[model samples]
Target: MVKEIKLLIKKRQSYIKEFWSYINWGIIVCSWAGVVIHIFRQTELKKLSNSLENVKGLKPISLTFFAYLDSLLTYLTELKKLSNSLENVKGLKPISLTFFAYLDSLLTYLLSFCCFFGTIKILRLLRINRRLSLLTLTLKKSAKQLLGFFLMFVVIFVAFNSLFYLLYHSYVRHYSSWLDTALTCFQMSSRHLSTIPDLKKIDTFIAAMSLFLFILLVVFMLTNMFVSIIVENFNIVRREPFNHENEVELIHFTIDKIRQWLSMSTRKRKIQTKTDPITEFPEKIDELMLAVDKLYGNTKR
Candidate 1:
């Protein structure tokens, strides 16, 4: 019994530690408030940091403040220096094709993580701009879901690209190159296909059949599948905020049930009370309520 209590206490301490780690990470994230960190080499941070002093505008801010800002800026520059190794992360600079796409994905994730967890929490604490805070949170959550949907689309689009490439290569002459076939498949999958009049050159039966199936897959099957996944997962994300109340109720219900079970045990009242309590999670309120009824008796007719 004492061992179980020790384990629970250790587990709880670990969780608390993780929560505070998140807050400290948030602080580090907010420390870079005004300075920008460029990704994908969009702009050179070195040039900005070096020239901050020489830029001519009557510097209204105090030198002490600017010097302190430069100190924080040095930490960022050191971090950027570490990123020199990522020169080849997004494929060769010559060709735009990314070597592996997940590197690009990591950008969105870090951005959302910092903004949603760090900046959003800080803004909420300020209580000055609730609407903006909510909007930031909504966009962060939605972007995660949208990124999943996009990756799914990429997989399906690749499969269909290969299928259509084969079909066009074997039976059709209108598509002059494999790249053309891929672009066509992507266009159809994205529902951005131009009018059918563009395909007037292809008048074969196989071509027509393939086109029919392409439209059917894009419009009828894949579109609905993607939409359903997005809607379902979006609801799951929306439900997360209410889970705290459910968890609290579950804790209370479990305690009461355990108390009753211990009091009714025949092994000896004190002996039962001394035993370690088991924790149970009710996935739904109805399940918890039903368990309570079974234990305490329900008055419903």
Candidate 2:
């Protein structure tokens, strides 16, 4: 029991040492900090804007009367101070907006990374499940081939993006810029066929041919090649013997023990048996049917 406790502590220490765990924790901390900072800044900004608007609505008072002169002077003095304060507040508007913009962008980026890294961490946690780990295993095994395919894909994609941009830059808005053209091409390959209509407006024949070629080369060909590579690697990996069954067995055992402790019955699988009638001999079909009928008749009697 002491050895078991020590081993558990060592395992936990190793888990804590993992860099991805640190990344996830860092993201959580930063995200919470960003949320708090955003709320505080937003409240302060709104208060400043509202105060400026309220102060701007205040009209100037006259100090023409002698009896009311003292009160008017004091009111005018306070108004002047408020006006000066408004000037300083006005200066902060642009700076505050810019800061808020930057903060919002930073928070968005952090959240995106948090989601991505969180998924990776979940996969790490669930790596014991072979079905869930198949994708990672396939990628690991086929990394070289996938890298090669990616290089080739990039070359082809760049060529097409360049071609599309050069050819339809003036005619199609999607191809107005190199970056837009590249995005449009990716969308096109992913079945976003919206650009085809725009291209058709330019020249129907050219648009038709471009669509056919792009679909054939990128969508069908490249996609199938990628799928084939992954599937081949998956098959190779799946055929190999697994050594993690012991861990899975242990998990099952623990679950079963818990269920027993709760006095819950374990699920029992019912085995179904089936018998198929033979019909191999076509010439003996009538005899077989007669025999079946006779058997049924005897059972009925």
Candidate 3:
């Protein structure tokens, strides 16, 4: 079994290595192809531009060619600028800097997403442990309820976000946009509470009322509902019965089996004590007699 497992793992690793090898080769080929194509295009365009500049008379054909060449150069320049903006960040134009910033932000978000899912995948391996399985089990059992709750939460959240944006967008800086308003609301819910003071400074009456409603609807109601759902599902998951062995038990069982298979167990094998054949035969006969008596004459007709 161990040999077979090792072979299977090696086979899988070979396939992964081959896949990545092909991907690397393909990237290299495509990159060189792109570089060659770009070089040829640039040289050809430069030749055309030089020839057009030396023309003595402005013929209609030359004029049209010059115009086309100018437009192409402009496009190529923009493309080169874009590539340079991503490749080299020093002394970038404003538009290029903005593009670079957006690219960085996007990469940052993607990395965060990758890390988040990677952690979840790692945690999945710990499901053999009882303590770790509870969290996953709870989520599995309460997935539907959580989804429904999240949808409802989003609806309520969006409504409040829009309200705050409309209410305080003119006066308060925090509620400037939908994103800012949502963030501000999250901060308030998380016990930051500075948004209320800022809102109150703008309009005392509106801020007081908005605070009461937000707290009642969002902070108190939604927070408690989410906690209650999780707790209820967690308790249910805990109460459910499972016969599967946990991580520690499984590990010990595996270790014992391996030790026994290798003839290395701490407890030695027991040896049977020999008895005389005459005494054993008499005992066997007595057992046979009891069996016959019980089968034939145990109950009287």
What is the total number of backbone clashes in candidate 2?
0
| lDDT of the structure predicted as candidate 1 | 0.51
lDDT score, candidate 3, position 192: 80
What ranges in model 2 sit over 4 Å off? 1-96, 248-301
Rank by TM-score (best first): 2, 3, 1
Off by over 4 Å in 1: 1-156, 167-174, 242-301
Q: Kindly provide the TM-score of model 3 when superposed on the true structure, using C-alpha atoms.
A: 0.52
lDDT of each: 0.51, 0.70, 0.66
Which candidate gets the maximum lDDT versus the true structure?
2
Against the true structure, candidate 1 reaches a TM-score of 0.32
Query: How do all the candidates rank in terms of lDDT, highest first?
Result: 2, 3, 1
Pick by lDDT: 1 or 3, better one: 3
Better of 2 and 3 by TM-score: 2
Q: lDDT per residue, candidate 2, 1-301, as tens digits? A: 3443465477887756455556566666766876786676566556545644544444432212211222446645654654454454433343233453454456556666767766777766667887887876777789899999999999888878887898899988889999999999989988988887788788888778777887898999999999999889999989977757446443666787789899999774343544354644664787899999999999999
What's the CA error at residue 63 for candidate 2, in Å? 37
After superposition on all CA atoms, how large is the RMSD of candidate 2?
A: 16.8
